[model samples]
Structures are given as C-alpha cells and as structure tokens.
Target: MPIQVGDKIPDVTVMTMTAEGPKPVKTSELFAGKKVALFSVPGAFTPTCSAKHLPGFVEKASDIRGKGVDEIVCIAVNDAFVMGAWGKSANAEGKVTMIGDGNGDLTKALGLEMDGSGFGLGMRGQRFSMIVDDGKVTHLNVEAPGAFEVSSAEYMLNQL
Candidate 1:
C-alpha cells in the first residue's frame, strides 16, 4: 500500500545538494524530530513543475514555516546535479530543500511510483505533498493524473 497519514516515513537514502557537494541523507534522519513539509514532483524542469509546483512552495515557504514547520522539501525523480540546478533556477535555496530520488528508491518505498513511459520519461514519482511530524505523516495530498489542485502550496498552506 502507498504511504498514508500516520505512517512513518520510509527509511531510505536520498540525495541533496550541499555547499560541499551532493550528499546522501537518510529519510529517517531527515525527518527525525522535525516537522517537515515535503512535496514531490514527477520530474524537475517540466512545465507544470517549474512554472507552478516548485514556485508555489518557494513563494509560500516562509508562510508554511511560520506555521511551525521546520523544513520545506522538494523531491524529484532526477539526479543530484539536475535537482540542484533546478532548485537554483527556481530560487529555492534556503527555502525548499531539493532532494533527488535518482534511483526512485524513496518514491518506490512510498509506493508513489508512476509509469511515465508514454512520455518517454520511463518511471517517475507522482505529484504529491505531505506533512511529516517527527517522522510520522500527518497529512498527504496526492494529485490525480494531469491534475494540480490539492498538492499546490496554496492548498497545503490551508491545511496547515
């Protein structure tokens, strides 16, 4: 079954770009003792993801944090280099943490993997967002195919 409210985030390693370089971070360690607002896009730099998905979070980051969220994270089924570049392009530095699920390890673990072969993208994570408090899920918003309503930052902000 897919990850749901009340479930602990899966223990998996994902990559995040650091000043030093790309670093591997364990999901358990990232969420431990922290209230995190994490959103995942199908891929980085895509039209919807770049124009709306990521920008919404970047713009609303402080608002979300003000509500007691410790961190805001954005994960995509791309490599560290691509993720880092994309984050920079979106001006997400210090606002949203950009994570790379290069191998889809975390996405598969969450049971949110989707087949994007029809688009020549092979496999990717679905567009979704969740609130995790100290490693446990408090809310999850997953979008239906070709939809972009619930998972937006505006919607998540309302949830908070």
Candidate 2:
C-alpha cells in the first residue's frame, strides 16, 4: 500500500550536503519534533523540477516558515554530489535542505518510485509534496503522472 496521511514516516537514512560532505539524515529525526514541508523531484535539474517545483519552495521559503514549518526538504533520487551541485546551481543553499536518496530506499518505502529510463534518466522519484508534523503526515499533495499544478508551493501554502 502507498504511504497515507497519518502514516508515521518510516525512519530512513538519506544523504544531504553538509559543511564537511554528504551527511546522513535520519527520516524520523527530520520530522521528529518539527513541522516540515517535503517535496520530491524526478531528478536534480530536470525541466519542470528546475523551472517550477523547486523554485516554488525557494520563493515561498519565508511564507512556509511563517506557517510554522521548521524545514523545507527537497528529495531527489540522485547522489549527494549531484544534489549538492544542483542546490548550489539553483541557489538553494540555506533556503532548503536538499536530500539525496541515492539508493531508492525511501522512495520504495513510500511507493512513489518512477522509471524514467525512456527519458534517459534511470529510476527516479514521482513528484509530490507533503506536510509532516511530528513525524506524521498531515497533508499530502501527490501530483498526477506528468502533472505539476497541485504540488506547487503556492498550493501547499494555501493548505497551511
């Protein structure tokens, strides 16, 4: 079954760019005692992801924080190097936490993995966003395959 609202997100290890290098972030720790907005993209620099999905959160980082979100997390089925470079390239430093699910464990646990080999990208994540409070999902916005409207930061902001 797919991960549903109220499901306590399983604790998983994700690599995120840190001052020294890629640091491991435990999933439960991410939402352990905070309200977070998490969004996933197919890859680091893909078209819609770059042009719309990520920028939405970047532009609304302040608003999201005002709404009580402690962290805005971005996940991609990419390595830490790519995620770090993408974050820097996208000017995401300090505004968001870019997480790398290089092994696809978290995506598999959530049942949101996608195969993009035809697009020349290997296995990737389905685009989606969710509000996690105290480690449980309170609100979720799952984008339709190939759709991007509902998962934007503006829409998620309205929910908060």
Candidate 3:
C-alpha cells in the first residue's frame, strides 16, 4: 500500500551529495526528530520538475520552514551527481536538501514508483509531497498521473 499519514517512513539508504561526494543517508536518521517537508519528482532536470515543481519548493523553503518545518527535502530517482547539479542550477543550496533515490529503493518502499518506460525513462518516482514529524507522516499529497496540483509548495503551505 502507498504510504499515508501516521505511517513511519521506511529505513532505507538514500544518497546526498556532499563536499567529498555522494554519501549514504538513512531515512530514519533524517526523520528521527525533525519535522520534514519532503517532495519527490519523476526526474531531475525534466521540464515541469525543473521549471515549476522544484522551483516552487526552493522559493518557498523559508516560508515552509517558518511554519515549523525543520527541513525541506527534494527527492528524485536520479543519481547524486544529477541531483546535486540540478540543485545548483536551481539555487536550492541551503534551501532544500536534494536526495538521490538512485535505484528507486525509497520510491518502491513507499509504493510510489511509476513505470516510465513508455517515455523511455524506465522506473521513476511519482510526484508527491509529505509532511513527516519526528518519523511519522502527518500529511501526504500525491498527484495523479500527468497532473500537478496538491503537491505544490503553495498547497502544502496552506496545509501547514
């Protein structure tokens, strides 16, 4: 089943780019005692993701954090290199934590993986957002295929 409010995030290893290189970060470590606003994109540098989805979060990072969110995270199925590049391009440094679900492990664990083979993209994560407080999901907004609405930063801010 898809992850929902009240569920604790799975303990899976995800990658984040650092000064040295890509490093493994456990999901449990991320949510252990923080109120996190996590959003996922199908892929990094894709049209909508680059133009709107990611920018929205980057623009609203402070506002979201102001509303008691300890961190804002953006996850994608791409590798740490791609994610880091995209973050730099979007000026997301210090505003958002970009994570790489390189093998779709986190996406699969949440049952949010989408088959993108038709578009030659292979397996990717569906666009979604969630508010996790101290290891428990408090809110989840999942977009329908080819749609972008509820998962936007504006909507999530309203929820907060």
Each prediction's TM-score versus the true structure: 0.99, 0.97, 0.99
TM-score of 1: 0.99
- Colliding residue pairs in candidate 3: none
**Tens digits of lDDT, candidate 2, 16-47:** 98779989989988889999999999988889
lDDT of 2: 0.91
lDDT of 3 at 72: 95
Which runs in model 2 stand beyond 4 Å of their true positions? none
Residues 1-160 of candidate 1: C-alpha lDDT, one tens digit per residue: 9998999999999999988989999999999999999999999999999999999999999999999999999998999989999999999999999999999999999999999999999999999999999999999999999899999999999999
- Model 3 lDDT, full chain set: 0.96
Candidates' C-alpha lDDT: 0.96, 0.91, 0.96
**lDDT minimum window of 10 residues, candidate 2:** 1-10
Ranked by lDDT from best down, the candidates are 3, 1, 2
lDDT of 3 by residue, 43-100 (tens): 9999999999999999999999999999999999999999999999999999999999
As for candidate 1, its clashing pairs are none
Winner by lDDT between candidate 2 and candidate 1: 1
